[model samples]
Structures are given as C-alpha cells and as structure tokens.
Target chain A: MLTLAQQLWIGLTNGMVFALIALGYTMVYGILELINFAHGDLFMLASFLALTLVGLLGLATASGPVVVVGLLGVVLACAIFAALINRTVDRVVYRPLRNAPKLAPLVSAIGVSFVFQNLGLFWGGLPLDVMGGGLAAAAPKSFPDLIPSTNLLGDGAAFRITAKDLVVIGSSLCVMVALWLFVTRSRLGKAMRATAQNPLAARLMGIDVDRVISATFLIGGALAGFAAVIYGLYVNTIKFQDGYQNGLYAFTAAVLGGIGNIPGAVVGGLVIGIVRALSDQYIGAQWQQAVVFGMLIALLVFRPQGLLGANVREKV
Target chain B: MLRVEQARAGYGAVEVLRGISLTVDEGEIVTLIGANGAGKTTTLHTLSGLVQLTGGRITFLGENIAGVPAHELVRRGLVHAPEGRKIFSRLTVLENLEMGAYTRRDPDGIARDLARVFELFPILAERRRQAGGTLSGGEQQMLAVGRAMMARPRLLLLDEPSLGLAPLIVARIFEVIRELSKSGVTILLVEQNARMALRLAHRGYVMETGAILLADAASALLENETVRAAYLGE
Candidate 1:
C-alpha cells in the first residue's frame, strides 16, 4: 500500500496542473459565458510545439544552465504561439456571434476543437526526432527527460519528493499566485471583473468591451501554454489525444467549483486530483474516472450552483 | 449644447423613435415626459449611443455624433445614468466610481470628481467598501448618478431617476438634479412622472406614441389643459 503522505504529494502535484488549465476555462467563461471547447486542443497543440522546439534546439541532452535557459525559451515561445491562436479563434469564430443566440458560438467552439485535434494529429506525424521519428502518428510521443529525477530529500525517505515534482508544483504555484495578484491589484483586472458583471455598464463607463474580451483570451491561452510545458515535463509522455481527457478533467474541475469564480477552480482541481490519487491506490487505475465522476454527480445534486457559486438564480 | 434632428431608430425593424427631434442648450435641464411605450427612454438611449440611429442626425458641441460609439460619447463628456440603475453589482462602490473615470487619464481631476460624488451622496462614501448589490434601491440610484458624476460630464442623460422609489427618495434625487443643473451640467431627463419632471425642468417636451405633442416652458406645460388631462392627475 502506498503511504498516505506519498499519495498526497502525488495528488497535489497533479492538482496544480488541473488548476492551471481550469483557470483558463473559468476566465473565458466568466467574461463571455461561452465554453471554448477548443481550449483543450490548444493546450495539446502547445505541447506539440514544446516538443518540436526541444528537438530543434537539441536540448534533450544538454546539461546545467543551458537546460534552464532552453526550457524558459521554449515556454515563452509556446505561450506567445498559443495566445495568438486563441485570440485569432475568438476574433474569427466567436466575435461574429456576439449577439446571436448562445448556441451558435458554442457549436463553433466544438468545431474549432475538432480542427485543433486534426492539427495535433497532423503535427504528431511530422518527421521530428523528439516524436520518435514520427513512425506512428497516433502513438504517444515520449517527452525528453530534461529534469533530473533524483529524490530531493535523499534516496532513503519514505515520503519521497523528486526534483521534477518540486519544479512542477513550485512553478505552478508561483504562476497561480502571480495571476491572483494581477486580477486583484491591477487596473485591467478590475475592468475584467466589471465587464464580467455587466458589459453594458462597462461600456457606459468608457471601457472597450471587445478589448477586454481579447485580453481574457490572451491570458487564458498563455496559461494553457504554461500548463502544456509543465505537463510534458512532469508526465514525460504525451499523445495527440491527451488534450481531450485533460480538458474534460479541467472543465469538470471548473464546473465543480463555481464556473466563474477564480479561486473556486483551484479548489475544485485539488479535490479532483486528491480523489483520483486515492481511488487509484484503493480501488484501481481503470476505476479512477468512475470514482471521480461519481463524487461529482453526488456533490452537484445538492449544490447545483456548484461549491463556491453564489446562491442567486442562474441567469440563463 | 446637444441637438437631435429628426432622429429615427429602433430594435431590428420596429421603429421606436420615429423621427423624434429635441435639443438641450448649455446649462439647461430639459425633461421628456410620457407614458410607457412613448419612446422617452429610447430617446435618451439614442442620444447616449446605446441605440443606433437609423436616420436623422445628432450634433454635440458642433461635431456630428450620430455614428459615435457609447464609450467614445462618454469620453466627449456625454454620460448616461441608465434606467434601472445598472450599477456593477459585484464590484465595490469605490470600484464602480473608479470605472466611471475609465477613459480619463487625469488622476487629479478624477479625485476631485470622486470627492464631489461623496459629498452629494454621503451614503455612498460610508458604503464605498461594500458591494454595489448590497445597497438599497435609493442608494443604488445615488450610486448610478454619482458614477456618472465621476466622468465629469458636460451633458448628462438621466432615464427614469424616480422609478420605483419612495416619495421621499424621489424628492431627494430631484433636489440633487436641481443642484447638478445649477452647477452647469447640461441635463436631458426622461420621466414617467410628468408633474414632478415639469416642476423641476426649465423646459418640457410631452411625447405620445413616438412623437412629441408639445414643447414649451415648464410652467406653461404644467398649466396646459391637454398636458394636465393626459399626464397630471387632473
């Protein structure tokens, strides 16, 4: 049996990833009330970008400061790439349907998701060394082990924590904290909140509502990029289809908390991660989804507005 | 300071404001009084750029503002305190006031306006840290007016300031309107309560079925037999 402490450590690291992706989902929903289904596929494409960069730069075998600098560069490039793609999708697909019935943009988002998935499939087939010579397009690609896996607390520790785990958790925490501060302290952040609450009033206050929406997409896509790099490094293997499963998990986390509440997404992600870890240990790996979803169904029955959602009647 | 010449606008195909025209000179309080569906609210909305004009023209301070967007109109000192007091319910009172000055870069001027808002509505100052939704109806209306004040508007468009409020609260709101007009803000007000509106305005326009029936000085309209029979409880 795995020790409780070990399981908790594993759960927390996994939870951080879910939290990052969930933030993307929640932020977009808060402003536009549209679920950008393509967001997950965007994350998947970003991971593929990270992998290609790693191959092109030949950083897989590098050591010391070169690895840190190369990783930072890869992350920055992927973030910019994803942010632009997300913004473009909004402008082309979602912006036109701003005043139409909500269903139109939602369906467009689903279509965009499929397009992104196909792009990911095509990307995986490219002749890249990091993608295992692109022999099988559908097969999971092995990510290079750039971060050493030595136990940070020495080899004899019962509750072991690796350098890789520390990097994933530490960097995610820093990013999430920075995001929290930005939303609470900055002028644009307050404008975002105001826009979310009332767009007409925001417009009357001389806020350019469209500009704020674009900024939201940019921030959300950047987060997905950050998550993509960390997810690749931590898991060390990624498939073109990884986005669907992980996106569903993050979306579930966002809904389980309040869909529009920022901190709620984080809490929901942690709960999901911990439950999955415990279920894997006690029940079985195959039953993880059943267990997590079962709990979600039961919790939602009592609180339809979600755990952190306000009690006001939802405006449909 | 503001002129609307035969303005025609509506939602989709239904023309609500059918070639309506009015004007507000500098330092004047003009009221539009009518029953529901008379296009009083629509007139204010068209002037504020919330509703698009399908025909006619609007000129503010010598520039044509017909095609200008709502936010741009606000930057040019045309502000609207909309019907139903559409305050940002989730934000704090202070934050709502800050949003009022979103287009202006002059911090000192904004601070001065903020202080004046607090002076006009002391309740807003005490509840500055509280969420806007928590305030009562009267307080929300005050916050709406105070929020408009934060923009330092040269021309203010107020819609239904007396809707669904206690008589005492309505009196207090109109008192502030008088004070605002006295301080040199050009005002165009729309009200369902014609008697009170005419009592407060320098001039009044009586609208019915999307057309203005009479435009005259306040006291003249108050005593006009047609106005008294249709609007005032004569």
Candidate 2:
C-alpha cells in the first residue's frame, strides 16, 4: 500500500512537469491549429539556460535563502529568454506562412525544432563549470542539487515526501491556477479566446490577431521555461535529446486531452504520468512507452474527443 | 462618411470587385442590393478592409483608407458586422459585446454603449451569459448587431442582417436599423432582400457582376421598372 502511495506521489510530480510543457503545445494549437514541433526542444534549451545560470551564480554550493532567491532569478531569466525566442521565431518563420498552405507552417515548425536541437547541442558544449568542464556535448549533465532532498515526513516514513516534491507540485499548481485566471478573466486573454474561435470575427471586433498570436507563443514559451527549471531540479539530469523524448510525451498528453483544450491538457498529463509510473513499476521501465501509447490508443478508440473535451470546442 | 472610387480587388488573380465605386455621406443609410454572385458582399468587405484593393482609392472620414488592415479600420470607427454574422461562438453574449468595444479605451463611453445595446436588444441582455453558438438564428443576428453597436460606430456597415430569420425577426432587426439611423449613426447596409432594403434605406445602389448597374434614391429605384423587375421580384 505504501509502495503504491509512493509511486502515485512520484507520478503526480512528474505529471505536473508534463502538464506545464503540454500547455505550451495546447495554447499554440488553440490559436494557430499548428502543433509547434519546436516546443519540446525549446524546453530543453531553457533547462540548459537554467544550468548555466546555476553555474554562473554558484547556487549549487550555496546554502539556505540564497538558493531560493537565486533559483527565482534563474527561473525569471529562462522564462524571458525562452519567451523572446519563441516570439521571434513566430514573427520570422511562422508569420510569413500565415496565408500559405497549412502544411507550410507545420513544416517550418519542424525545421525550427531541428534548429533548436542543434542550438541545444551547441549550448551543451559551452565551457560552464556545471556542465562538467563541457567535455561531452551529447552527455546528460547532472543538475545541481539546489533543492534539498530532505524528506518532510522524516527518514522512517515508508511513503517519503521530499521538499523537492512539494516545490514542484506546489509551484506547478500555482502557475496553472494563475494561467486559468488570466485566460478566463483578463482582457487580452479574452481576446486570445476570441481569436482562437474565429480570427476573422476577432479582427472584425478590432483585435490585432497577429499580436494575440504572438502573445500566445510568448506565454506558451514562458510556461516551458518554468517547466524546464522544475524538471531539472526534480529529475536531476538533462540532455540535448531529452527534449525529443520528453517532448513526444508532452505532445501526446496535449492530443490525449484534446488538442485545443486547456484543462484537458492538464488532465491528460496527469493520466500519462500515472500510467508511466505504474507501468514502470509493475510491468517494466523498458515497456513504459508501449503501455502508455497502448492506453492512449484504447482511450482514443472509445473517446476520440478526449476526457474533458465536448463537441462544442473552446480552443484557448 | 465613406467613399470608394473605382476600387478593384479580388482573391489572388480572380478580380471580384471591378472598379466598384460608391459613397456614403454622413448621417445617411445607404443600401447596396444585388444577386448572390454580384459582388455586393465583396464591396462591403473591401470597404471594411478585409479584402485588399488592387486599384483605386478608399476614403473614410476624409482620410484615404486604402490598404488599411481590418482591425485598424475598426479603430477608426468603420465597423463591419460580416455577412455570416460571425460572432465568437464560444464566447458568452456579454463577452462578444465587450470584444466589439475592444479598440475603444473609454470606460464610461463603453458603459454607455453597453447600456444602449441592451436597451436596443433586451433579448441579448437576457442571454448575456449563454454561449453565442447556442443562440437561435434570430438571437444570433441580434447579438451580432448588438455587438456592432457596442463599438459606438459612426459608420456601421451591416451585411445581410436579415438572412435566414423569420419575417417577424427580420422586421425587428430592420426597425432597429432605422432607429440607429435616427440616433445619428451612418449606415451602409447590404442585403439580398431587395424590397425590404429599399424601404429602409434612404438611397440604394444596384450591383451586377462586380460593378454598379444603377445608383439612385431608394424610392426612385423602387419605382424604376428595371430595378423592380430584376431585384424586387416583380
């Protein structure tokens, strides 16, 4: 029973990271109906940025309040960096193909994904102390143990709960709630929803559709940045290829939840996370992907619109 | 006031508006009537800047608005309630109205316009919380018109407002259009219902195959045998 509880906790934490990354997928899809293939690689680069910041600040060796403050700064920096890159890519690559065939922007996104992967590879080669003297460009670098692993329930507890788990789950929940409020309550957010439904109608309503789309990319990239930091601290290792593997998982979660639906992405992420955890334990870690994909196929066969999705679509 | 002179436009090599020209003076309701493929809808789209003009000039409120984007045109108070009544289906009635007021920053004025829209269409107020797609065709038309009104437009371009509605609902929408004209808002109306559009508009233009076939007073056009035969279903 305790073992089951421990796996569930791990699943929940892992699911939160997936949910954060999945939001980037779902938001961009909601606006443009284009699955941004570059999104996962963007998350990987943001993790690289976080690692670089940790090395620059020497927060890995620091103790107490400084670690918290330094991490907060790193999160902000990575978010801004990723957001600017995401926005710029849209402006330069995707905007030109707005009136082109749907396949054009999609192909462009894949191209951007490759470019970002190369950028991540190049970043890994930077001579940063945190990157083990930048020896191997393809190696999985160990993330700094900035977050203490002290189990909050004490060492004797069978179902261990660490401060790291609390931070990951707590921060993810807070970010999700804040995003919900922004989408449901703010004026620009309302405009985004309007544009998602019918961009022509939204323009008739005096909304600059291009601006709203850029904002979507910015917000989506920022979420990925936040997820990157949390993922590095939790998983403790990241590589250039991590984006490709983890990105596939996050993209699947978005589709599983219904491509354009926000709350659906969260639910899908949690389901995938729990499925992965349970499969990893009961079946085998090597069979994890097969199990998750098999369940997804079954669920899609029964409910193609996903768990929370209705026929009446609300993209944003 | 709006003016178009020999405007030519189309979708990428297919010219739809072949040098179409018309003018709407301030404080007048001008209607454009034509058959389905006669470029009536295209004219409205061009005026609202949705379709780019390939030739000639468009002047709105004394400034040449040629090549202006649709949303920027809205900021200048040239609002288009498009042919299909393209309301945001997922948004509530109230959100749709708020979106109409998107460019304007004046809170008190927006509030005043909101109240006026509600007063104009009480049914919209009743269904303010309901999603737009769930509304009946008549209700959706009302929501579309009410949304346009929320922009506090000086020149409102309404396209096929009475499309697919019952006769009573059509009459209600037309009556509101008349009321809006009386309240000092200039209007450019496009409709397939020629008889009703002629009765409501002060002046009318007849379009055929991407050009204006006739331009005259609405009552005069109503009396003309050609217009009556071709358009009024005589």
Candidate 3:
C-alpha cells in the first residue's frame, strides 16, 4: 500500500500540470468570456513541435549542460510559436464574430479545435525520427526520457521524489507566481482586468480592447506551450488525442474554480488532481475521470459561482 | 470645436438619429433637451464613435472623425461619461481614475489632473481605495464625471448625469457641470431635466423623434412657449 505522503506528492505534481493549462482557459474566459476549445489542440501541436526541435538539434544524446540549454531553447521557441498562432487565430476566427451572437464564436472555437486536431494528425505523419520515424501517424509517440528519474529520497524510501517531478512542480510554481504578480501589478495587467470587468468602460478609458484581448490570447497560449513541454517531459509520451483528454481536465479545473477567477483555477486544478489521484488509487483507474467530472457537476450545482468566485449577478 | 451635419444612425434597421445636426463651439455648454426616446443618447453615442454613422459628417477640431473607433476618439480628447455611469465597478476609485488617463503619457500632468479631480469631488479622494460599485448612485455619477475629466477632454459629453438621483444630488451634479464649463471645457450635455439643462447651457437644441425641432440660445429656448409646455413640464 502506498503511503499518504506519496499519494499527496503525486497529486500535487499532477495538479501543477493541470494548473498551467487551466490558467490559459481561465484567462481567455475572463477576457472574452469565450472558451477557446482549440487551446488543447494548440498544446498538442506545441508538443509535436518540441519533439521536432529535439530531433533537429540532436539534443537527445547531448551532454547534460547542452541538454539543459537545448530544453530551455525549446520552451522559449514553443511559447513564442504558440502565442503567435493563438493571436492569429483570435484575429482571423474570433475578432469578426465578437459582436455576433455569443454562440457564434463558441461554434467557431469548436471548429478550430477540429482543425487543430487534424493538424496534429498531419504533424505526427511527418518523417521525423523523434516521431518514431513517422511510421504510423496514429501511433502514440514516445518522448525520450531526458530527465533522470533517480529517487531523490534515497533507494528505500516509501515516498519517491524524482528530479523530473521536482522540475515540473517547480517550474509550474514559478510561472504561476509570475502570472499572479503580472495580473496584479502591471499596467497592462490592470487594463486586462478592467477589460474583463467591462469592455465598454475600458474602451471609454482609451484602452485598446482589441490589443488587450490579443495580449490575453498571447499570455494564455504561452502558458499552454510551457505546460506542453512539461507534460511531454513528465509523461515520456505524446499522442494526438492527449490534447482532448488534458484539455478537458483543464477546462473542468477552470469551471470548478470559477470560470473567470484566476486563483480559483489554481485551487480547482489542485483539488481535481488530488481527487483523481485518490480515486485512481482507492477506487479504480477506470473510474477516476468520472469521479473528477462528477465532483465538478456537484460543486457547480451547489455553488454556481465556483468555490472562490464571488456571487456577483451576471451583468445584463 | 465640434460639428455634426445631417447625422443619420440607428440600431440595425431602425433609424434613431434622422438627419440631426448641431454644433458646439469652443468653451460653450451645448445642451440637447428632449423627452425619452428622442435619440438624445444615440446622438451622444454617435459623437463618441460607439455607434456608426450611416450618413453624416462629424468634424471635431477640424478633422472628419465620423468612422473613428471609440478608443481612438477618446485618445483625441472626445470623452464621454455615458448615461449609465459605466464606471469600472470591479476596480478601485483610484484605479478607475488612473484608467481615465490611459491614453495620456505625462505623469506630471496626470498627477495635476488627479489633484484637480480630488479638489472638485473630495468624497472621491476619501474613497480612493474603495471599489467604484460600492458607492451610492450619486457618488458613482461623480466618479464617472471625474473619470472623464481625467482625460483632459477637448470636448466632454455628459449624458443624463442627473438620472435616477435625488434632487439635491441633481443640483450638485449640475453645479459640477457649470463649474466644468466655466473652466473652459467644451461640453455637450444631454438631459431630460430641460429647465435645469437650459438654465446651465449657453446654447440648447430641442430634439423630437430623431431630429432637432428647434435650436437657439438657451435663454431664448427657455422663453419659448412650446418649449415650456412640452419639455419644461409646465
């Protein structure tokens, strides 16, 4: 039987991963009030790009220091790539339909999600060595075990803490703290919060609403990109369908925390992660997803504003 | 400094501003007085570029700006303190005031204006850290007007500033409007309180349906028998 500490550790690490993606969902929802369904596929495509970069740079066999530098390069490149793509998608797909019926952009987001999935499928078929030599597009690709998984707590400890897990949790914490400071302290961040509260009022104050929205997509996408890299490293595997599963979990976290609330997303993600870990160990692996979603539905029904959300009436 | 000629606009297919024309010269309080559904708010929205003009020429500071975006208009010093006092309710009073200066770059000028706004409404200064929504309706109206003033507008548009407030609050709001006008800010005031509006304005236009039915000096409009009966609630 696993110790309680081990279960908590596993859950905390997994929760951090979900938190990264959840931030993207919550930020976009906060600004535009539109769920960017395509976000998951975006993260999937970013992982594929990261794999391609790893192969191109031949970093798989490089020395330790070189590998570290190359990994940093991959994270930065993927972040910029994802941020630009998200901004373009917003400009082309979302901006025109902004004033249309609310359902219009949502439908467009679903369509974009499908498009991104197909793109991921196509990317997996490219003749890249990192993608299992592109032999089968539908096959799950194995990400090289770049980070050593030696137990940091010594060989016989009941709780196993690895460097990979530490890196994943540490990096996520850094990003979250940075984001908190940015949203609370920066001028543009304040403008974004204002825009989220009232677009008309922000515009009246001479804030460029379009620019702010674009910045939101950019920041959200960058977080997804960062999460994609961490996920690839932690799981040692990538699949086209992983985006759908992971994205669903992140979306659930956002809703559980309070759809538009930032801190709420983080708390919701951790809660979901803990629930999933506990359910997998105590209940059954097959029932974990159901339990997580079931908890979400129950919480939503009882506290519609979410755990941390204040009960503000929806503006007419 | 601002002129609208034969302006036509509306929501979708229904025209709300039908060939309405008016002008406000530098340093004048131009009031548009009318009853409900007279397109007074629509006129102000069009001027602020919130509504697109299907047919019209809007010349502000000698530049044709009919199709410019609302934020761009605000940057060019056309500030509107809208009908509903649309303050950023989630933000603090100080943050709301800071947002007013979003387009401006000079910190010293902003500080000076902040001080001036505080002098004009000391209550706002007292509640600087308070969220705007927590304030009473009267205080919110003051914050809205104070926010607009932070933009250092070349022409300020005040739409129904006294709406849904007590008579004492209405009087206080009008006093600020008069004070702002005297301080050389060109204003386009839209109000249902025709008597108070005309009393404060140097010039006034009586609008009916979507067009201006009469235009003259505020004193002349106040004296007109039809104006007194229809709008002034005689």
Candidate 4:
C-alpha cells in the first residue's frame, strides 16, 4: 500500500548510486572502447578502504566537525588510492595490449576483475574494528552509520526523506554536474573527445592520445572512490562479493542508456532504479531481478543503439 | 629545413619505402609525385612518424628526428594534413581548429593563428558551428587545410589534398596551397595529380615503387619526356 511518492524517493536514492558507478563505466568505454569489467571491483575495494580508514582514525562515534573532517579525509584518500590503482592497472595490464586484438584487453579486464575481487577478500580479513574486528574473511562487514538518519521533513510527513538520502543524492548530483562541465568545457576534455573520435587524427593534432586515455582512467577511478564512500554510508553493510552485483547493475545501466553516452548512463540508472523499486513493491521480491533484466532485453531489441546512443556505427 | 637520407620503412613484412632520400629547403614547395601504390603516401607517413623508419635518417632543423612520435613531430612544427580529411567528425569545425593548436601554449599566438585560418577559409568561419563530418567534400578539404594552418606549421606535409574532389574544388585547393607557400611555410606536397603538383612545386621528386627515380626543378620535371609521358599523361 505504499504511495507512488515513496516508491519514487526510494528509487531516486538507489538510482544515484547506480549512476555514480555507471558514469565510470561509460567514461572508460567512451575513451578506450573497453568494458573495464574491473571497475566494480575497484569500487568494492574503495569501500573497504573507507572502512579501514574509519577504523584507523577511530572516527566511528565522532560527532559534528570531527566527523565531517574525518569523512572528507576518507573520501580524499580513497579517491587518490583508487585513481592511482586505476592508472597503474592501465599501464600494466591494458597499455601493453593496446594494439592487440580487441578481445585480448576485454579478457584481461575480466581477469583483472577476478584479481580485484580476491584482493577485496584478503582486505576484508585484516583485523579491524569497523569490519567487526575481522571475525571472518568471507563475512559481510557493517559500515558505521556516520551519517545521521534524522527525517528532514519533520516526523509528520506521509513520505520521509532522510539526511543520509540527501547526502547521497546531493553529492551524486554535484559530481555528475562537475563531470559534465569538465568534459564539455575544458581543454583536456576537448582532447579526450577528439581522441575518442579518431586517435590518429588526434595524434597528428599534437594531442598525446595515451595521456588523454590515462586521464580518463584516473577521473573514472576517482569518481568510483567517491561513490564507494557514499555507498558504504548509505548501504550500512558491504561484502567482498558486492562488486560483482554492483558492477553488473552499473554495466547494465550503461548499456541501457547507450554504452558510450554519459547522460544516457544516468538516465538508464534512474530508470532501472525506479523499475526495481516498483517491481519489488508490486511483484514478488524474487521476481524483481528478472523484471529488470527482462526490460533491458526488450528495450535493447528495439533500440539496439541504446536509448541515447547515436545511430552511427562505432569506429574501429 | 628537412632531409631524409636512405630511409627504409613499411608495415609488417611488406616494405614500402626502400632507401628513399629527399630534402626540402626552408620556404620551398617540394612535391612528391607518383602514381597510386608508388609509396608517395607512405613517404609522407614516415615523415610524420606514423610509419617507423626501419633504416636511415631524418634531420629537421639541424636535429635528427627519425623515430619521433607523430605528436612530438607536430610540436616541433612538422605538421601533416593527412591524405584523407580525417577531421574529428563529432566535433564542431571550431573545435577541430582548436585541436590543431593543441601543442601551443601562447594564447595570443593561438588567437592570431585562429583568426588567420578563418580569413584564409572564410567558408570555415561561416560553418564554425557545424560538425566536421556534416560538411561537403570541398568544405571538408578546406577545413582540413585550415586546421593545419592553425598549427602555425613551419614545414607542412600535405598528402593528396586533391584526391577526390570536383575539378573546380581541386583548383580552389591548389590556389590555397600556393597562398600557403607564399606565406613562407615550407611545404612537402604529395599528389597523384602530377600536372598540378609539379606546376605548384618549386622542386619535384618522381617516386616509383619505393624509391625516388628522379629529383630536379619542377620546370625540368614538367618538361622531361618520361615525366610528361608517365605522370603528366601528355
């Protein structure tokens, strides 16, 4: 008997999470034309990093300004750590295979995904308070609810909005907007777009194409780090295996919107979120996954270029 | 000034340029004229660093630059307007021009070059907001030439600028090339149209297969019996 507004609010908050991850997927695909299957695992590892930072700083129960500063510090550290890891992975795994057959890098990406997942498993085993004192390596760990859950619209509203929800949605919006401006207005952004269109032509223009691609990975990874922090704060619990599911969802979102289109990923994520919420409410909980994927297939069959993808064929 | 001595290069297992040697003095239009598959395009590609030189040397402005990357070559004012008008299709004409000045950091110089490019091709200025791919073939060629001009190139390598255009468009393109040479930019012109190329060039080289068969003054090549018979189609 939930109202439509309640469903929409729930969908929006969840969609914001998917959108953040989806942006990473789309950005990398736009630049490299590779799926970057390891992105989800990168996000998962980032969350683990955030948890470790929370414990190391002992800021779980801190309040007010201290909590704000600690959270900011965690976000900064995770962003840098993820960006570096992404850049290194590009240099070590992807760059060498840049001229190989397209399928080679894709296979390498899948292998990298497995490596990241295993790393997450090992990271979860470290003795830490935030990870429940590392009780079991494979167990899901609870993230401290550093964000207050107080209702922002007072206690009397028919549909409530929590402060945590505001933080998640507001921050996701800010990141997306900043990314949009960076890609559209800046000189480096223009270089990235040019590189994507034609690498040889870009090089002839004196653009360092490899540098542009590396910058893409760095920005994508940093965004994933930001998402990791928000995801941990909102979801309250995370597992080493979480990346697979989150990544699949984000990848699906990117495909649904148009794989190389940025705005399309965001819209696709929101749509998936709303559909998941509505289906979970109206249909059986077990059928929600089936419904979401079914919709994707059906939409894809009709709009093969994706919802916002250009009709032009992808250049080799 | 640019010089290539005994240069050898090609794709895997297929040698396209063998012991090719040529030179272009400062402010000279040096044309490389040959039929299709005669290694004309490959020579330009090697000069731009798109193709690796398996053997020999390239010296530009007193520095050896045989193995420099294409991007680095451009930074040294060795700009190439490629054979095909490979403009960034998705970008607007203005953005494509902006990309041409990517290596330059001087705002005033960039601005001045941009204005000059627009003046050279007023049509490009008119279609500044249009996507590069949306332009007509003639317009795309103009944009391509204009894009190279934005780089403020000291030695501009143009590959087949008249490859597939109407007779009138080809005439217009050649006129621009003449104007560019008048502006004191060193030019290396590659063209299948031997008559037009030799007419425009101060010096001309006739390439057959992978080697230069003849190198002389443009007027001498134009009047030579073999050049007239094989290339000029007279």
Per-residue lDDT of B45 in model 1: 85
lDDT by residue for model 4 over A59-143, one digit each (tens)?
A: 8877778999999999999998999899999999999999899899999999999999999999888766568535698899989
All candidates: interface RMSD: 2.5, 3.4, 1.6, 2.0
Model 3 chain B is weakest, by summed lDDT over 10 consecutive residues, at B82-91
Collision pairs in model 3: none
CA deviation > 4 Å runs, candidate 2: A310-316
Chain B TM-score of predicted candidate 4 relative to the true chain B = 0.98
Taking candidate 2, what TM-score does its chain B reach relative to the real chain B?
0.98
Tens-place lDDT per residue, model 1, B66-134, is 889999999999999889998888789999999998888999999999998899899999999999988
Backbone clashes counted, model 4: 0
Which tens-of-lDDT digit does each residue in A1-118 have in candidate 3?
5666788888889998788888888889988889999998899989988888887888888999999999999999999999999999999999999999989999999999999999
Order of the predicted models by DockQ, top scorer first:
4, 3, 1, 2
Q: What does the TM-score come to for chain B in model 1?
A: 0.98
Tens-place lDDT digits, model 2, residues A6-82: 88889999999999999999999988988899999999999999998888899988988999999999999999989
CA displacement after TM-score superposition, residue A241 of candidate 4 (Å): 1.4
**Candidate 3 segments whose C-alpha is farther than 4 A from its true place:** A310-316
- Each candidate's B-chain TM-score, in sequence, is 0.98, 0.98, 0.98, 0.98
* lDDT of candidates 1 onward, in order: 0.89, 0.91, 0.90, 0.90
lDDT of 4 by residue, B34-139 (tens): 8889999999899999999999999999899987899999999999999888988878999999999999999999999889888878989999999988898889
Q: Say which prediction, candidate 3 or candidate 4, comes out ahead on DockQ.
A: 4
